[model samples]
Target chain A: MEISSKLLEKAVAEMSQLPGIGKRTALRLVLHLLRQPVSQTDSLAQALQELRTRIRHCRECHNISDSDLCEICNSSRRDRSLVCVVEDIRDVMAIENTGHFRGLYHVLGGKISPMEGVGPQDLTIASLVEKVRGGEVRELIFALSATMEGDTTNFYIYRQLEGLPVTLSTIARGVPVGDELEYADEVTLGRSILQRIPFEGSLNR
Target chain B: MEISSKLLEKAVAEMSQLPGIGKRTALRLVLHLLRQPVSQTDSLAQALQELRTRIRHCRECHNISDSDLCEICNSSRRDRSLVCVVEDIRDVMAIENTGHFRGLYHVLGGKISPMEGVGPQDLTIASLVEKVRGGEVRELIFALSATMEGDTTNFYIYRQLEGLPVTLSTIARGVPVGDELEYADEVTLGRSILQRIPFEGSLNR
Candidate 1:
């Protein structure tokens, strides 16, 4: 589109660089910003700048944090021995919203996707292994997605801690809690049947 | 969702304030920005800040511009006797993209929507009438949307120029160039049939 102003064009270009935002949507956003108070734009810019410049990652979990240690890792109430491994901060937020897990997290940042040139070394796998080898972590939960990349990352991490004292486990794959069995995918349904737990165990949960 | 850091949470909150962006999407975008180089975020922030702080509106047309007069208003090649009235800068961009209209524009800023507490005075209608009274414009073309608010805004502006010498016209309403007849809406299809142009005129365009 032929934008009249260079400043507006530059703003829209930068906005469209974000994932899922196209040129039209970017223009709409920039126009909306123009209509609002300058302070609103200033606040947005300040927040984004501060987030990138001052944001820190937890030394232990590799999650985004303002300090050396993240809130999850710093909290004494959370079970440090039970570490849930996830792909990124979004997963950490999702699991935290569920309010089911009571353990600390190990954010791998991303999976080992060969197609994307992200190998095991690109992730936080080395630090995770070191955490397990440190002997404090009693259980390492693989909470990655069900994609092939997720499985590959899990197996790679598992191999790295073959003789470690920590017990390895993965999130269950099956029909969702409130979903009907008929709607479940064949692979998930078959796996759920093969890995069926005791009736009492299901009832207890 | 429970974010680990206050800085990260603030950024997500600010990002979510944008139109069409939800909390989850905001978190995803924020995380994506966190993963990229700090300079990328800095550039985005800088562009937005400069756009908001330094952007100016054309004194004659009220369109976004870097200077007091917009490029369109400043250009001598554009028709000085014709003016297309539009709802916002987006419409100006859309018309300019067509490369057909060489007339200047008068941006209303927004339609007169009483439901949203917007009135005739809220727009740039007075300046448009003043432009017509100045006697330079020989024709005024209404290029607003087909919505009720658009019609109302057009009528309000038309009423303001009651005794003016300029000829008043609206953009032709008809079926879109490549639209299927069967899928066209009843109102549009009926209007297209009622306001049918001569076959030769349609064929020529």
Candidate 2:
């Protein structure tokens, strides 16, 4: 609150500007840094500075990278023909950690949130459509979040590729793998039943 | 978890090394920074670097400062004969926020904790003894935490100042203001009862 040092106050103010960090937590963190070796703060500052200055986005999918093309887009082992669309790089990382999909990703940067003034133009929708029109992607999978904004973005993109030759698909919506049916939301449970897959087909996944 | 970019991974690693931050929270913060303007990140990094590089400690009290003497030590209004000894600058800030103390502070940097390999030699105990020996401070107030380590540090300092011509006292322990009696811990309640002061003294405070 009443910090004695101007330098400490400035550092705390800057740190509290970050999302989810409050003034007290920021003070605790700044105090912790003060107790640590100067090299720790030097490395932390260097990492953050480099992240902002040198970070790049893949020209194809718009995922964060250090070079023009991201690692996923440049990999030959991934299925370039199958593109899974996501809201941001966090989603890409989440999907990649599952190890279930071999397809490459197309990061849209964010969903179509009209309330937040983020429209289709604010995202990478146009570039994604261009990628599909290049004829290399045989299937474009909609893997966005299951929110209204996610659905709107998917529909908007689907309309843009209406007459295209590429096949369109979306990830299955159902109760999660380890979740109890009773605990699942009504909409998800109903959708799971309505779009139930064949017993033999489910065995493979 | 499975971050694709090396720079992103490095930044997340450094950010998560802070107290109470985890990998997921670190990723969330890093992504939030990526979404913000580059100037925001630049300022945050610059502030942290400057705090580590340019901050100074007061020669008299050891509180963090921008010059040789801290604001408290430089102030002529503060009582020169009374000193409140604390564990660190955080305590100094906390006490200053209360706006009740008008005495100078002596920061010990840390309390004595033998289990953590911290001893009297690791703290500013020698400097504190020297201050008392200088004969300007007529009273020494112990304002350290009410923990075993804090008490040990206080007792150690009391022994060091046994023959000095100075009055020594510790802060009162009691049910905090606005706290319910039923909720007060036994140790504090017992101490409050044992060290009961005059009823008129309570009315004045």
User: Which candidate gets the maximum DockQ versus the true structure?
Assistant: 1
- Candidate 1, B27-83: lDDT as tens digits: 878878887888889999999999999989999999999999999999999999999
lDDT of every predicted structure (CA atoms): 0.92, 0.93
* Predicted structure with the largest lDDT when compared to the true one: 2
lDDT of 1 by residue, A1-205 (tens): 9998999999999988888889999998899889889998999999999999998889999888899998888898999899999998889888999999999999998999999999998999999999998999999999999999999999999999998898999998888889999999999999999988877645635
Query: What DockQ, between 0 and 1, does each candidate earn?
Result: 0.89, 0.85
Q: List the residue pairs that clash in candidate 2.
A: none
Q: lDDT tens digits, residues B50-109, model 2? A: 998889999999999988899999999999899999999989988999999999999999
- RMSD values for the candidates in order, in angstroms, are 1.5, 1.6
| Per-residue alpha-carbon lDDT of candidate 2 for residues A1-205, written as tens digits (9 for 90 to 100) | 7887889899999999999999999999998998899999999999998998899999989999999999999998999899999998888998999999998899999999989999999999999999999999999999999999999999999999999999989999999988999999999999999999878755646
Error of 1 at B70 (Å): 0.2
